[model samples]
Target chain A: MAQGNFILREKEYLALQASLKKLLANSYAKVVFLVDKNGSLIASAGATGDFDTTSLASLTAGNIAATGGLASLIGEKEFSILFHEGERDNMHISVVANRIILVVIFDRRSSVGLVRLRVRRTATELERILRDIDAGAGKEEEGDFEELTEADIESLLK
Target chain B: MSFINYSSREINCKIVYYGPGLCGKTTNLQYIYRRTNPESRGKMISLTTDTERTLFFDFLPLSLGEVRGFKTRFHLYTVPGQVFYDASRRLILRGVDGVVFSADSQLTRMDANVESLENLQVNLREQGYDSDRIPLVMQYNKRDLPHVASVAELHALLNYRNVPEFEAVATTGVGVFETLKAIIKLILIDLKKGGR
Candidate 1:
């Protein structure tokens, strides 16, 4: 349950990148990414070369949402951390501030214990940044978008 | 909810196609997936049962060429419409920005259509979204069927709020893009008011 209508700003994204970098450095994970609860990739740090993160982000959100549903059905609040183990690659998905998801994808290079410990520390900083961003979001900024004409929409129809 | 990525110069929106089971919601996504250019569309993923009934959801990410220097991406998802899959449907609508209610046009499925519409409203509320405030469009599908109900009748029954209802035979691609475009238009208009 991310705050409604998430708008990413450059300043906030920079801060997020810094946090994600800290997590990856501390954990030695292959990649660390952040996705809104609704499944949008807010930012990613570390190596994601030649990978399709859009689909990954969408499916990650779906997996977590379904897990949350299953949690509530059994009278639990939420299953905060989801980990998938593979022969070569593993993923750790944790909830941040109940609004965003923090995912750390790694290999045998890092142990689950290390990723978990680093994520716990990183989540706090990321949550603070998200709260600040949400506080400043949704404002009709000056020239936020170039004025769209009916023709712009019509062109899409074509 | 719409996610505007300033860094990527992109705006992403989630649009869900909701309806009773087998009411052409999946077909709508298929047709759009087929018609779109390879560069602009991502792989269409369908999570389904062995019988091909949508078990969880179908996700299709489409890029409508950049508008005003920002790429507009619509992540279209279809909810599992079976009555037994109510919990899955609620999860899919959690942060949806727009909804396209695909109603079955057959007279025999009239009650199912009404029930699904009401179910959608209830699910939206449960997710903390106002059904009235969210951008919504109605598509009376399977109109090519000989025994389908008329648009007027579907309107009287399903389109209580009169949200830009369209008559679509989704299998053949008729009115598919139109329904999609209409909802995106409404979403963009709403985005203009408050979205930065």
Candidate 2:
């Protein structure tokens, strides 16, 4: 597998959920999400029912990718954090573990300072969990696809 | 790269459409988006300029049913094909699991096709992906045009890997789904090989 590929087992999923939950509580944010740089939603917490998380994940990844490109042109490695303030809501996006994106959506109830402080602590925890997931993926020999056959794959598309 | 979520029994993969300016990469995606069942497709987003040219990229999420009790989802993206958008194109290729090189079949655009194909290889290398190793499908689009190159010529020019190739007219939906299915199958096959 390529270096950025990963499998999220139940153990790491639960840990990620807990950390995101804590961050949402501490910062009084409406929602928090853990998305891969490729725009896959790993986990999310808080009020998520109103928004379409799949689109959010894809757009957030695009935003980060574009920002990373601009940073490179200006002779920087990457812009680690991005904040977008809307009239009624605000978004706090950060890069965690160099491969995952941490997103927090908050309203006037949560200030950027509070969110940033809480995110700093949660980012470290998330990074540790992501590293563990990578390590686990590396230690495994075979994947669930070992039992997958060509017929099975073809049938799905059909 | 693909993401396997055991917790959700889901597999998510990213596939990119690459080609030169005005080569119908976005048209291919639009055809699929319109033909797909509403339940199996999500919102399609296109970041385009005032003249309707792709500014950054276009994104569409799709569900390809389930395999072995695990649902398969594909995120399709089209990069800006203009020459100056190289920076933006490179950004969209990050973590891509498969690619569909949409080559313009017009005889005059042959040089553009070769240049874009070479650019694809270079960008893939920069992203730590070997173009030869990645799951790729060739799409020779605009075949219905008056002045077009032969499929043999297009293949000779762009199909160095001799991968599965399709002749498409994206506007009228000819060969759109065929091209998409070929790439999806290749990606799944690669995944079955432990993503090697």
Candidate 3:
């Protein structure tokens, strides 16, 4: 991938993590995994604890991709959320925009129903955020990268 | 007519095994990997975190028989069945073709199963897919374990809509192929009807 594409993807990744943190607020989740459209782990939140978010993010992307295909087969358009229940914990996976995914893990304390409901609303919000970011990127193309001084890159590094 | 033109007339479709954490979603994939012919499948890749939990995803691409001059391909994936990973799950669901809802058939897990199913519905809807219309198959996995709920009981709670459902013991490979074949069939049949 070109440096420009890499930078954009990285930016998209960071944005997704920030968005996930905001959505998971008050949810009491242990960890949050964010993946790209191709099922690559872009970012994660909460405790590293005992789980691996990178692998989980990739797998989650693969799962959703397959699920989306399945949805199309049945004459549907896309896939939104997938939930799995366990004795001690539960998993909630939701699709955000067309390029990112959100994975939430919670225990008995949190209600799966509540998470599911919250996820639906968050998906819509995340979509809007992504659209805004894309628009901003477009606007920046007009003398954007050319205008950035060495100071800007240095500040970003800081 | 050859619909997919990129590859060797091989129609590669993705299938996701989704369920709650530890509900045998991974088990289903493991069983398939163990039993499938090596020549027909690619190397199984599982990405994990520092502690070795599935972080990004698990991928296993399998080659099934040809259909209408297309070599049937199925890439199976399992989400990090943990709750906090919703973002990752959403990303993985892009361009999916079929799904296997691996439910833990334990009496104690009844509520979780219901909640998970509903979550599936909501997630599918967000991606513009109606849960009722997707090519979905249900697998009540972990039947070998004691204290697990019976098939009938699970059906009563999770199968209210009456989609294709199967009883599975993922650890022993029981119902694994049945579940896989069922979903694959659904995808192929769907393609034939939709003219995709």
Quick one: best TM-score, which candidate? 2
Higher-DockQ candidate of 1 and 2:
2
Q: A1-158, model 3: which lDDT tens digit per residue?
A: 00012113345546666767865675777777765565444456787557745446556766777687778879988878788898887899987766678888988878888788767766776777667556654233222223434443333222
TM-score of 1: 0.95
Cα TM-score of candidate 3? 0.56
For candidate 2, what is the DockQ-based docking class?
Answer: medium
Query: What tens-digit string does per-residue lDDT give for candidate 1 at B41-91?
Result: 988989999999999999999999877778899999999999999999999
State how far residue B165 of model 3 sits from its true place (Å): 1.4
TM-scores of the candidates are 0.95, 0.97, 0.56
Error of 3 at B61 (Å): 0.3
Error of 2 at A6 (Å): 1.3
User: Which portions of model 3 miss their true places by more than 4 Å?
Assistant: A1-158, B1-3, B50-52
Show how many residue pairs clash in every candidate, following the order shown.
Answer: 0, 0, 63
| Residues B71-186, model 2: lDDT tens digits | 99999999999999999998899889999999999999999999999999999999888878899999999999889999999999999999999999999999899999999999
lDDT per residue as tens, model 2, A19-38: 99999999999999989999
TM-score of chain B of 1: 0.97
Q: What DockQ, between 0 and 1, does each candidate earn?
A: 0.52, 0.73, 0.03
RMSD of each: 2.0, 1.2, 17.3
